[model samples]
Target: MALHFSRDEFASRLELVKARMKEEKLDALLIFAQESMYWLTGYDTFGYCFFQCLVVKADGQMVLMTRSADLRQARHTSIIEDIRIWVDRTNADPAQDLKNLLMDLDLLGSKIGVEYDTHGLTGLNARRLDHQLTSFGTSTDASYIISKLRLVKSAAEIEYAEKAAALSDDALDAALRLAKPGANEADILAAMQGAIFAGGGDYPSNEFIIGSGADALLCRYKAGRRNLDAVDQLTLEWAGVYAHYHAPMMRTVIVGTPNDRQKELYAASRDAIEAIETVLITGNTFGTVFDTHARIMDERGLAKHRLNACGYSVGARFSPSWMEHQMFHAGNPEPILPGMTLFVHMIIMDSETGTAMTLGQTYLITDGPVKSLSRHSLDLISV
Candidate 1:
């Protein structure tokens, strides 16, 4: 099936890049990174090395250069104006081609921004290109220019995201329902994986997180063979990929009814999530959510830094980026914007009572407010 967006939707995306290029004062932006490529072209071939390096001219001319092998796929997938294929990846020397592409647009005298964070400049190709260019520049995060353009969802993009959200919802429901007192973490993970695939999702960016009991304090707890104890707390988080877009979600469930301490912590954490959800807005900084969540945990004497990850970028591919599109993994004071995707996972653990709990949800900044992509509840589930 050929999934396509309306012409107006596509035009908005192109305009977005033009606006960003003007802001950055760069002639044309070069993108070799998969996340950036997917964000601009909406084509995800899952090619680590075979994908094209794209250059978006400030005049609204977008050109993508990929390896010869990917020419067919690139031609079919790109929704842009120009497609250039490099017939050779190695000895043939595409440096001149890149140099020529820049020279054609009078970019030799202009600034060229390269994404070093997502696509590093440490390869033979980069060195060769560096030698060929008269003037070259690089930055840690090109996502700033990219995210500003990608944050707002068009009507068609929202339709795909909605479908992804439904798939994630069904998968989470399956995992929660299948989770039981004697079930192992592997069992839960497998069930969720099956459900996600069954629901029509293609890939998961990171390994699915299915932490249990005492292991809840550990962030990104990978699924293991450990059987769920009667009182084990299970934290579930995974993102679904459809046409390269991400619909991420997380859920928390206990093997059995929690103790008083566990209940209190769960209540506090849920309160934090709800509070953030209510107050989250386009102009609000991600720090706002983190600080408020920290306060709820502080009052309960829970270690805030124990599980320290606020949220990250959600877009065409699962880069797990922040709202600000920061190059580094640190707090960002940038205000949220519509179409920006972020994953906020609030967690709590009390080993004294042998209970660990957490909940995560992805939200898209909207015109009026932030909307939850993960429609699941915050209530602690007991299987």
Candidate 2:
């Protein structure tokens, strides 16, 4: 099997997950989160856009219910041997298949925990499963049971994250080299993604957030692309993924001469990140860290240019977003801890001046201070 971790490690992860299941009084867990599946057994596949689930019994027995397309995928990538395939006929109901599987295991009447928030389980399918299981047993929303267990990184996980971070630095360097006057934004993005893949990295959970000129002020990825202006800022946010672990980086490059206002914004953005770093150590509240960023930007008179949240937890994630559930924002009382990966971005987009300046990097939280994952300098780049 192509399991990413050793058998012992996978076994330990299962033990942790099952322990959490017991704590929640969950007789069984219906894991629909792809990340949770991969973490438990190295079941890697993009087939999660369809219906699939990994059922873990309280006794620690696990089974994967998926489509035929992912049959070989499960065999090769994961240690899951007892795989069940659900047919794709128009009238076929996989929920019924799941119910049968539960009955076969003599768990049909037991309380089960379902991952209601994952993309792997659609609303229609969830309702169907809930309706069917209502007669058999109770299914509770227990997404956080497995998710919270994954917040802290193991040693092997951190190693993969470190490699991803270095490759992300390489990607940023390649993209920066291509950020010249009259350069195509598409080419820059290609260079960035290509660098990561060339370095033995996997595709990130989401598309790169890249834009130039007026579009640079935006944060999320969009449909159209543009060329770098001779005197404009090119904003980029990309990640290097390895073994599904992500190390994301963000920076804004000036194609030509930067105005005084742009430079001032960049300085404040850098200072804001530095201030946040001071409070990102272990034992600090995540909100405290965000407050540092907010205070820096607000005190610098750039509050209007800031984003609502400063950063979030990062880990092995699949598309839609690389952001983990734990976020650093106002009123979020989540505490920072060692072995956590976080990405903090000092995003400042001044719509009034039509300029953008953003600086971001990922870090591994240690006992004392956090270690920078991205190798690139946090200073604003000009080319």
Candidate 3:
């Protein structure tokens, strides 16, 4: 089936944000950047360029602020009711222009919060924004506010993500079917990507690396002129967005019967992933999961090569980002509440052997148990 999401799903998420805003003592949440804008509004007019900003206040009023040129398309597509369009000047900074529009809309001094993301705001842009905010006396900084709201999963979002993971599994199915001793890694990539479009999926956030043999030395590495060998181990690390949510994961593939050494390591990784999956129930601290995996690897003396965590974030988008959750994650200890979903991938890269291994799965946090959404088998496959 073609992949898509219901508009009600996004609407429900916005309401979730509204509830978060009330708890956070926020009047409205100001949104910039592409991902959050799409997550809240359901309109994705390629916000990668040009002016696209939004203000969602608590009065059930969500206003989208954009330039005059973008207003027509935005109103035609955005879920927001109020469309505030600003006229562009011949020679002016868009940031300053946005500030002026905010002041005109009386949003100044409204405890507005901005997302600086990983990088701190710079001096020039900060000075310009400060000068503009001073004109109307508004307060602003990186609140890490939107993140907490984004952590918990909404029902409709899980539904779409579940489907997205299935679509990705199908993509890998097609890729593995095409894998052969004579084919290059790119050969299977083309086949996998073709299946993605055939199933109505869009582009992956990062490149999908499907290399084998020498190419597998570096983790998150790429496929080169190196050809797949019948005896060589294969790795497939890929995740893409469906309806703007992240469905990140990976899988291991072998072209034919595996040798003794390869088979042993593969069994260890596969078993380790299974052990983690079995215990990934709701309310368990993520550290508990990591410590357990670390112990398993410690028993094998493979702890140093094991990653920090067994899983990471899965949402309406596949991020090319560094994970920094304040709770229930590494460096931060908080309970794993129900309504959060994540994709767990265990990767082992051996540069000396020119080999790599991966075992991945996706799960949703529920009151009773963690429901596994990825139905793909976790065994060594002979393609």
Candidate 4:
């Protein structure tokens, strides 16, 4: 088996899920989230755009239902032994096939937990699945069950995260070195991505968020290219993926001397991150950390420029977004725990001045002071 972790590790993860299933009185878990499958059985594949399901029974048995193309993929990357293939046709109902498989397992009329909040399980497929299970079994939304279980990092997982963090620092260094007046934004992006691949890193869950001037104020990535301004600001946010685990980093680069307002915002962002770090310990609620970050920025009169939340959980993931369901949002009552990895970014954008300053890095919560994953300096870079 070409599993990422040892057999014992995989077994431990399975037991964790089964324990949760027993607590919830679920007979089986119909997993549609690609990340959940990867975490449980080392099942790695980008073919989740098509219909797929990994069924985990309460007793410990596991089965995968996917297209014929992914049958080999399951064997090569996962520990799942019972693989069933559904044929492709003009009008194929994989959901029906899943129901048939459940019936074969004698789990019909039993309570089955389904992951409803993922791209792998689209609304159409979910509706079809519900219709198919109407007569076979019961399906309930248990998306957060597996997700919450994955928040705490194992030793082996932390190794991958550290490697990813190193690659992120390297990529950001390349970006800062290549970012200068007259440099093309696209070329700068190319340099950073190249640095990642050259350092043996994999593609991130989302495209690198790279922008300059007014575009920097916006958070998401957009197409097109423009030369760097002689005295402009550039913002970048990207992650390094190692064995599907991600450690993201963010920074805002100044090509020349920044204005007074920009300097003030950058200082506040730096101080806010430092202050927030002091409170990231086991037993503290995430809401408290977020509130501390907000108060620091709000007290600096940058409330409108700052974001509502500062960070979220990071882990092995697939496309669209790297953010896990666990987040550091105001009023959230979830308590921080050891082994949790969070990417906190102090993003401040003065829309009127068209200035953006973001300083962020990943951290691992320990028993005492949190450990920073990236070695990059927290100060805003000025070239």
Off by over 4 Å in 1: 1-3, 49-51, 87-97, 104-106, 119-143, 221-224, 318-331, 349-354, 367-370
Better of 1 and 3 by lDDT: 1
Instruction: Give the top-scoring candidate (lDDT).
Output: 4
- Pick the winner on TM-score between candidates 2 and 3: 2
Clashes in model 1: which pairs? 52-66, 151-339, 244-316, 312-321, 313-321, 313-322
Q: Which stretches of candidate 4 lie over 4 Å from their true place?
A: none
Model 2, which residues run further than 4 Å from truth?
A: none
Tens digits of per-residue lDDT for model 1 on 293-362?
Answer: 7777777777643365456656565443322353112365766667666677776655565566677777
Kindly indicate the candidate among 1 and 2 with the higher TM-score. Answer: 2
Clashes of 4: 0
Each prediction's Cα lDDT score?
0.66, 0.89, 0.65, 0.91
Prediction 3 TM-score vs. true: 0.85
Candidate 4 accuracy as TM-score? 0.98
Candidate 2, residues 133-158, lDDT tens digits: the string is 99999889998887888888999999
Q: After superposition, how far is residue 13 of candidate 2 from its true place, in Å?
A: 0.5
lDDT for each residue of candidate 3 in 15-119, tens digit (9 for 90 to 100): 787777777666656665455666666655554355556767766467777767766666665566687765667865556776776766667677666654522
lDDT of 3 at 257: 77
